[model samples]
Target chain A: MTILATEALTKRYPRVTALDQLTVSVGAGVTGLVGANGAGKSTLIKILLGLVPASEGSARVLGLDPATQGQEIRRSVGYMPEHDCLPPDQSATEFVVHMARMSGLPRTTARERAADTLRHVGLQEERYRPIGGYSTGMKQRVKLAQALVHDPKVIFLDEPTNGLDPQGRDEMLRLVHRIGTEFGISVLVCSHLLGELERVCDHVIVIEGGRLLRSSAIGELTQASQVITVEVEEGLEKLAARLTETGETVAVEGRTLALQVRADETYDLLRDAVVDLDLNLVRLEQRHARIEDVFR
Target chain B: MSQPTGVIHDIGYRHYDGPRLGRGAGAVALWVYSLRGTFGLGRTFKSKIMPFLLFGAMMLPTVVSIAIMALLKQEPMSYTDYAVFMQPIIAIFLAAQSPVLVAPDLRHKVIPLYLSRPVTIVDYIGAKLAAMIAALLILLVVPLTVQFVGEMLIDLPMPLHTHEYLAALGGSVLNAVLLASIGLALASFTPRRGLGVASVIAFYMFTLAASAVLTGVLESEGHRDAASWSILLNPFFLVNAVQANLFGTQPTEGLPFPSGAGPALILLAVVALALTGLYARYRKALAA
Candidate 1:
């Protein structure tokens, strides 16, 4: 069963259309909600989380209607919001433990769970210190910890990689990936940058103007256009001429020649083309389309 | 709905990100987080120094009152009269302070955490109001009790007997609760904290000044009793109307200050309506 489904889900603000008839179905595992800023990514996440009511259509999370069943959905779903929300006075231990207790754990159990969760987020030594005293990286970890402390069914992470340094972004992406594949939890992670989602998501849902531009498995998105790129040292003209003579459609794009190939014949054609041309095949790989390519 | 794709492994405390428990448990989790918000303690860290600062500001007058008491000998000021003078001033200060407690959450966008939870908007407003009033009670009402007790210890005539004291406590609590509610309502109207504060003060100014002007004009025109209803239009006047009844003060300018208990009660109802209207507006803005 689809963990989430939306049918023509639309949300309209006074001045902007946040989501415009967006329809998508998400299965288990990490699904990346990919779009640019103002591409309705946050709006979709809000609707899915039942925070913002949709102006049109419908949506469901785990078969519960997000519109009517917001509270029920939120009860089972964890959300790590994009903005910073840590209380300055309380220690991470106190805050997360309080959250754990609010999630219905007993006093002792909540404390244990908070400690365990904070430690799990790599905030062991500093967990007792007030969150205001922590660094941004540490603060981000606390945000992640509170979302996980309750052990929710699925988590909606809106721009988890936002405002992080390169290393922090890498760590956060790895954590997001682990949340799905390693921990076996379903994740709906949103990002405006396409490449980032490509790395961590099993399924990619691209949205524009609050509407679904495309929704497919990550592999499928990269596979639909079978264009193989090849680079050779010198003899590049000969390689293109030889490949053209052999009835392969070839075009010089930058320093490399991009060849349209049938999925099944791509390997055999490349092998014969390389041998026939006496060219040094410095590199050969399939040309993957980027999110930018879709716009172009 | 995905058929529980993986096992619910009990890793005790590993950094895995799966749903740990059930939805019923998640609701409970949000409730606890809501409490943190009520206390002005959240992941954004607004609670620590802010609440204490607010408390200190609200109770500054009490500190001044204590200092004044120490300088005087043999109870020069009647405790009842002095407390009456201080309570309204405290209420005004408390009213001004109430919106500050709520403004940060809206301005900071910290409300998303609560909105994302299984909590409804009503619960959110209720919790905020309760937290603000509770903090005000501690800051404003508690000190009044302490002062009353000190007056008794100083062997001065207790203020208005036990009943009077209870009535005073009740009046203060009502004032705080009503003022805080009004503050929250006003705060909800704007995202700018300054605007919220200014609007609340403006509300107090317009009501009091208008009532005072009308009453002054009425007395000058020899229609003393006609302006009694104007007292119902101002919260301060309405409160004073009740105070006049309780303390048996002489009619100001040959006219009953309270008019009748009926107008004051009616004014309270009107204030309630205005507050409700403000809350509705705020909720709409939040929805937007």
Candidate 2:
């Protein structure tokens, strides 16, 4: 089911159009909103959250119109903003509990939920420390914790792994995956990194220059192409010659050959050629189309 | 099926299926939070210094008055004059604390976090203004209440009238609302706390000084009516004039305006303008 839908939505600022007649539908599961900086990712999220009004067209979030029912939409949808929005003087416990109370949880329930959410986000002892003293990864977890403490139907995470080391990014991605799958919360995780989203996002929407570039399921977008890469330890030249003689297109790299898998029997043909040539097959794998290729 | 190798631990991340109290509850929560923030309740010790100091300063005069009444056997001050006596301290308190109520949220860009909640811009602005007014009311009323109770306990010279005391209390509340609205309206203009504090102080100091000088000059030139009108420019004198009129007390010296309905009307107009400006400021800030 479509959770968020924007129809020809446009946002025009004085000097630039932030979102220009963009139209797209986002469904459940972990969806990645991929765009370069200034590609209108933040603007689109703001429009969906009703933080900024669109200049033209219409948008609906969770079946509520943003123009009139923005408060209702926000009540059901949680948003983790892209910028540094946490107050430095407040500890994660204080801030998240306050946010939970703001979401209408009773005082005791708010505290309990905040503690649970903080623990779930991997912030335990540090939750008591002021956010000013937190590392970037810790601060990001606090941000995520506040968003989850409210327990909304969906969350719009803008650049969830923006500033993180490789390990931190991987950990954050794992958490995002768990939030969507284990917690059963739909997530619209925004990021400029195409490869990072490829792991956690079930669907990917690519926008460029404030317009829709592509929106498809991750499986469809990254489906295996008709190209197979074969690496041989020895007889590389012989393998290349054998593949060409069989009327197959082949591109020779340093130590491997990229051949087209024209038919299901193409694998058997290549295997037979390798065996007949007495070539040692080091590797044979089909190349999958990456989400980045759609942008290119 | 193979038995599970790992234990299923309860992580305690339960979904909230309870009552969602919607916008009204959120506004009340924000109001309470902002009120606590005004006194630095949930903040560090460094953040609590200014508020406590100013509050102590506000209480100092009443304490001194009570001491003089007990030790020297004299009536040094009255409830009617409490606001004027506490004017500078109150101004400092408002100047210092208004930014505490507003600037941090904007400076941290947490306004978006707030806006993304179920509350509207009006609800957010209203809650903040209400919080500031409540804080200022406490600052305005507590010292006066202490003086009233002290005089009753010591049997001071002045005759105690419940009606007059109630009027003074009401006027003090009005005074708090006026000052808080004006201070918060100005503080809401910028995200920088330093700028917010500087602008609020500058506003109060410049207007009070300019009006005092202007009223003095106009009165010296025998322009009594013009002088009375000029005092309205300074919120301190205007509130004093209205309070004197409300409490049935003589207008304090340097108050160009006489105790009458005209000054009261002028004070009400200024409050209306301040409130309107406050509303407009938050409306614009939250529009994005």
Candidate 3:
């Protein structure tokens, strides 16, 4: 299903156009919104959540019009903003429970759900501590817990891994992955790093200068290309010469030979050439196009 | 089909399929939360100090009155005049705590989190204002209630008129709402709690000073009508004027606004203006 759709949505600030005629649709599963700073990623998320109105064009979230059905959309869609928005005076449990109640949960149910969400987000014994004393990663988990406490149909996470060490980033990404796969929640994870989303996102949408650069399934965008890389222990020069002589496009980098695979038999031919040259085959693999490569 | 390898234990992350109360419930929740926040309940000890000190100060006048009535064998003060006597403390409490109700949310940028909920901007403002008004009413009414009860218990020789006492209580409520609306309105404009406190205090003190000076000059010039009209500029005097009108008491000692419908009308107009400014400020804030 198309969970969110924007058609020529535009947001104009006094001195700049934050989002300029951007049009895109996002479906189920985890989708990454990759963009540079000031590329309108935050603007687009704000527009979808109905926090900000578009200067022009129309948009819908979960089949509800943002202009008229903002309250309803917010009730069904969760948003985790990029900045540090946690109230320092409130404990993680208190804050998350308050948010759950704010999302319309009964008091007891809100508490229970808040505890469950905090546990799911990997905040256990420390949930009772005031958020002001929490580490950056723990604070991020609290923010994530509040967004998940209500169990909304979809969530917009803007820079969930904004500040974290490598281990913390990995833990956050794992939780995000589980949220989409295990809980069956649709996620629109926004980040500037395209490589991070390549692991968890099933689809990727690239935006630049407030415009859609590309929107495609991750599999299609990062499909295995026709180029295959072959590396041998010896006879690098001979293998390059032999592969080019067979009308195959080949380029040599160090001891590795990168050749364009012409047919299904291209692998057999490369194997035969390695055997004929009596070279030890070290690595033979097809290069999959990366999401970063598409950005370049 | 192959048997499952891992056990599906209950991690308690169940989906909520129950009836969602939506925006109305959310607004009520916010109201209660903000009400608790006003008293610094569930917050740290440092957060508790200001409210406790202010609340203790508010109760001090009643304690002193009761003590004098009991030990000194003297009638300390009249219940009807309590509000006029307590106006300064009320002003300080309102100025200090109104920011506690509003500024942290804006400073922390948690307004977006609130705005993203089922509630609208108006509901958010309404909840916060309602909480402030409730807090202010408690501060205003509790002292009067204590005074009334203490006087009754002490059995003063004069017959206690219940109607006048009730009228005084009602006037206190009105004064609280008026002061709370104006204080929150001023605090709503700034995100820094210190700035909010300073602005609210400055607003009340400057207006009181300016109006007092203007009223004195006008009275010296023998412009009685102009002096009476000038009292409306100071909210402290305006509240007292309206209360005096309500309780049918003598017009407050130096201020010239009459104890009649004219002062009451000005009081209501000022409250209306303050409330309008509050609503406009929140509307602009949430829209931004």
Identify the leading candidate in terms of DockQ: 2
TM-score of each: 0.77, 0.91, 0.91
Candidate 1 Cα deviation (angstroms), residue A264 = 8.5
Docking class of 3: medium
DockQ of each: 0.26, 0.67, 0.65
Question: Which of candidates 1 and 2 reaches a greater lDDT?
Answer: 2
What are the per-residue Cα lDDT tens digits for candidate 2 across B195-251?
999999999899888888988899899999888888777786687788777776656
Candidate 2 on A1-296: residue-level lDDT in tens?
Answer: 88989999999999899898899998989999999999999888888887788999999888998888888888888889888999998899999999887777888889989989998999979899889999999999999988898898999999999889999999999999999988888999999999999999999999999999999999999998999899999888888888899988899989889999888888889999999998888999989989889967
Ten residues in a row with the worst lDDT in model 3 chain A?
A44-53
Give the TM-score of chain A, superposed on the true chain A, for all candidates in the order listed.
0.86, 0.93, 0.93
Report the interface RMSD that candidate 3 achieves against the true structure, in angstroms.
1.1
Candidate 3's error at A30, in angstroms? 1.4
lDDT of 2 at A98: 90
Best-first order by lDDT: 2, 3, 1
Query: lDDT by residue for model 3 over A150-251, one digit each (tens)?
Result: 999999999999989999999999999999999899999999988789989999999999989999999998998999888888889999899888877899
Backbone Cα, N, C clashes tallied per candidate: 19, 0, 0
The second chain of candidate 1 has a TM-score of 0.69
